[model samples]
Target: MSEAATRRGTTSIAPPDLLASLDPLLREWLPRQRWFAGKGRPVTGFALISATELLEPPLASPGVIHLLVQAEQHHQPIHVAGTPGHSSAPHADDCYQLLIGVRKALPPHLAPALIGHVTHGPLAGQTVYEGLHDPGIAELLLERLRLPGRLGELRFGRDTRVDIPFGLVPRALGAEQSNTSLVYGDTFILKLFRRVVPGVNPDLELPRALARQGCGRVPAPVAWFESHQPGAAAEPLVLGVLQPYLKGSADGWELALRMLAEGADFSGEARALGRATAEVHLALSRALPTATLGHTQVEQIAKGMTERLEAAAQAVPALRPYAPGLRSAFDALAQLGAEGRIWTAQRVHGDLHLGQCLRAPSGDWSIIDFEGEPARPLGERRMPQPTVRDVAGMLRSFDYAARSHQPWAPEWADTCRAAYCRGYAEASGSDPRTEPVILRAYETDKAVYEVLYEARHRPDWLPVPLAAVRRLAAPDPARDPGSGR
Candidate 1:
């Protein structure tokens, strides 16, 4: 056992047993956390994969321990295959990185960070809490990345020729969903990926590739940390990424909401953002491999969309009424595919929405969060998809903002969506609007996804996507090439 592990008394008790004792606490705590993805489901158990003491006594006033734990949720398989009288696995699992702080007595200032007091363990009576809430621990984490080093199984390193300044006060960024981010002064922000999976996270992979391709629309990665578990077959799991922070930039989502509130036109801003999206897409196509989706592949894509719609309808009762209309969109896509319509597929921002964008003071848009959809598997997210998928997501986002702003501005959303597609056509030399069938299909799929997302995460926002479902499901006379309606 390493020195830090020994000090934490990992030698005294097996890791599984140690984590088992804390499972009750974690089960209660994990679901309450904003970053927890398994919300609305019960966390049945936890399997501790690795634990490293980032900071221990003597090195610091209080101690900090970093842990990678797999939380298993109770799940029932739809059907069991190849079994006469047996059920499949009852649990689905997701891995999470936890930074736990240990102290003999909780300071009043650290009260909010408290996870709970360790009832029985080597560190019994010690108050345990989230370490990221503590600025000292956050600063220490940045310092660890500042100098290339390995602590236990965790490796912290920077990109070649990258220099990170030390001793800057760290503050946590708020309103993040799937990750915890700490900003060091005004220089850099380190995003700690909460739900972790093995292999390269696209958040790091895409930014690095874009930087190499000389794409300035993304924040440049400075350093990153990953963990390699012993005997693990897969590649190292990315734990966090550090990138230069763009100061004074406003989130695109907030900007759109603001514009809607003031009745200000956003077509120009939307158009420029569309161009920026094209630039990034072009860079990604140059940096990575691209694929042409033939009839067979397009059929598969359409099938996937139908599957998703069925799943969403089952989950959200509001979608049931609109299922027939939605099916028409996917069916049209399949018919188009059957006609040998070929579409280009390449790596895209994946989950491009207003919130994933930022507008700088220079009026240029920069995209962030290349992790794709948080709900999908990493492999699926990494797959190349039609660029119109991204374009459709942005269009859906425009509708989302307009509807969310009250008094529902459908005209505003339509105007911005058209301007965005026009700008994209100008930059990429491919008109997304011209492919009305594909664009409509992608937009409907995105809206279906939003229905489930809002139903689960934000119930009040359910009407936003529900309304979209009705509109997209209905055939548009204006969309008919022969009809002027």
Candidate 2:
């Protein structure tokens, strides 16, 4: 087919017949993917949002297809005695981006990326595998980004100030959770968001803002691509971002684990990490709109936290007994709001942690992955939040690392937490420790979130957050002097 014919084809570049044959394979293959969100529930069906042919027969050896598909799954209905308990809609739809590569025969090296044989599709008897694993597909994607233009519904763009080098070797990084990354010639790493939504993702939005502010703690994006919906009013969904890859850098997670193994102190590194975080926060505050949470907003924040706790308690029976104790943390915030105490809020790294940071050999810390919590709505992730939320996340990370160590090192976590707060205070001029009420509330909220997440995803790790739940529930007078013990 000619390029014009392909453009004029049906909205779904992959024909309906092809989708029908591909559905069963996806239902089987998707759940196994680490990036797939609908793991526990059964995939009822898949709806193709859009598809584009990046490469096909005659032009390329193996065809490459880019797809935006939604996976629908049903949640268990709640039963109540008073009413006939019928939920409005039992199913939920999660949109995902997939790059599928099709070939005639399976290659030994690419066997791991195989989805399975399509019994009846446009190309029946064609072998399909993940596109990122195919060098040809990766090269083609980079080429598209190199030249800014629109291809079908997808738009490719790059930072004009920086010239992107061509013919760079590509290799996908395997350690990511909800996204896949391809490192090109050890110079640029392109992150492909697997689970996609219909707005500008923070991973792309915040970096551009920080870059404009001349922030050195975060890497700026050099190239990116997004797909526009057919409707005029629909927003473009970001598909991927290409940024400079930091060579000879180690992530904070591995560094922390190694330090723990060597029975070394991590307080110095934690303090530096804290300072790095404060720098990023300062830059973001300067670059973005900042707000002061009024009494009404404070009350709403407390109410939201309380609501999350209630929902978590209902879902996980283990959280039921400690619900009252947990409620106190949020209630303290509400009480502070009642007293007319206000706090500053700004754009922050919504989901900050050890793994989100990298340390160069020179011992400089660089924060990465501003996508925030993957489970959160796009609007919520982009909203200006109290910086303490990020501080709480890092503190919890230290606790998590300590717990992962043999025999559990609570003292180490405590020392590191204090050091981190001190470093933040030194850099930001405001100490999180002084704002005990709000800090405790955010920490408690983070712990509740962790509990629910661990219970649902990693049952073995449930004990880690439960330990925090127990401690936060019964705030020690000595450890948490301002927790209203």
Candidate 3:
């Protein structure tokens, strides 16, 4: 550990003026980043919470810096409470884990990741870019994980039971939203959590548990690293995780859209995906502690759903018209709780969707990204929740994919939803449809979340969730009987 990587009193050592020099570059670059949670608001300033020089310059041409920078901004109210894009703590600055590479000059291929030239501070006249995009820096990260050890406050560890091969080429993946991923020789992929909070992230926790349970439905973690601040918090902040990459595996969203374009039936794939989801859920339940949500817990869940709807309605005028009807979903859920109903809860993939699943060439499905809603608190995400929450998210995803087609294919989405439910029922011994009230409430909550998200981020896509909002708020008994129709 270098002097700057050490802690003095309670503060992590930050090189003098390093953050000051990078301030302008980050302010301009952060908001435009896909993983940036504080979008729509300008970054006022940044405070360096921690900085670790993984490879110091003068010794290395392109040195790597691991930084936990807290960005100060005028954060908006949580868009839809507890949703993915919204920040967990609304009143505080957002902390980001950034792996930056400092180079005197950049090559052509690495130009896109450049933050800009630093004209002041320790890195004056050096070019800084996303470190993970640099193959050499990415390899250094893998080396750290390969040998379980500590670099300053950062610790790296791997599954000793598994051997990670060396000399794998690294390449950054472009499709991720809340994190950055780099593929290593088609054998391993490392996910660097962009927006971080202190605690063991579920992305690493759930998958490791599943691996021990011998559940292959989700890829097992290979190696990982985290920031361990002794005085800051009880738990360390999980920075990045390396897991086995499913080579030639097709993304479920892309596959769904392709099938839709070809006018092919996707119910089979949807059904298989459902079975895979249930398997993971079952493994999680068995691997982790399970609980029953009594009247109080149930009431809290309903209250949260209702509160989210109200918040979303306030932010989105369109949601106001349907707010009254939407409240009924949560109200009904609360009524059941008041009447002494109880539901089983357990650790679940809080943000499950088609996009999170991958179909291997052998037709098997594997789920990924157990980080839950990226912006939620790690502890809240790690808590037990009704498994139906995951089911509702996947159902919403099918609808999203269907809407992406030229002409909206409600039937296609409907068919996939039904097939998925049937498949889950077959595997889990409990159909999500059987819990009509819970399912409807969770699904409604998810739709309300989407409405606010799309309205805020992609205004053009707002109609997708608005359509669901219309259908969900209204009751057509002939078509569906679940919504008190």
lDDT of candidate 2 at residue 107, scale 0 to 100: 85
Backbone clashes counted, model 2: 0
In candidate 2, position 251 carries an lDDT of 88
Query: Candidate 2's residue-wise lDDT over 312-357, tens digit each?
Result: 7776777778899999999989999989999999999999999999
**Residue-level lDDT for 423 in candidate 1:** 81
- If the candidates were sorted by their lDDT against the true structure, best first, what order would they fall in? 2, 3, 1
Q: Which stretches of candidate 3 lie above 4 Å from their native place?
A: 1-14, 75-91, 476-485
**What is the per-residue lDDT of model 3 for residues 16-100, given as tens digits with 9 covering 90 to 100?**
5889989999998887889897765678999887888877753557877888999998755445333333333343588999988
Instruction: Enumerate residue pairs that collide in model 2.
Output: none
Span of 10 residues, lowest total lDDT, candidate 2 = 80-89
Candidate 1 segments whose C-alpha is farther than 4 A from its true place: 1-14, 57-59, 76-91, 480-485
Winner of 2 and 3 under TM-score: 2
TM-score of each: 0.91, 0.92, 0.92
Give the lDDT of residue 59 in candidate 2: 43
How well does candidate 1 match the true structure in TM-score terms? 0.91
Cα deviation of 473, candidate 1, in Å? 1.4
Clashing pairs for predicted structure model 3, backbone only: none
RMSD to the hidden true structure, all candidates = 5.0, 4.1, 4.2
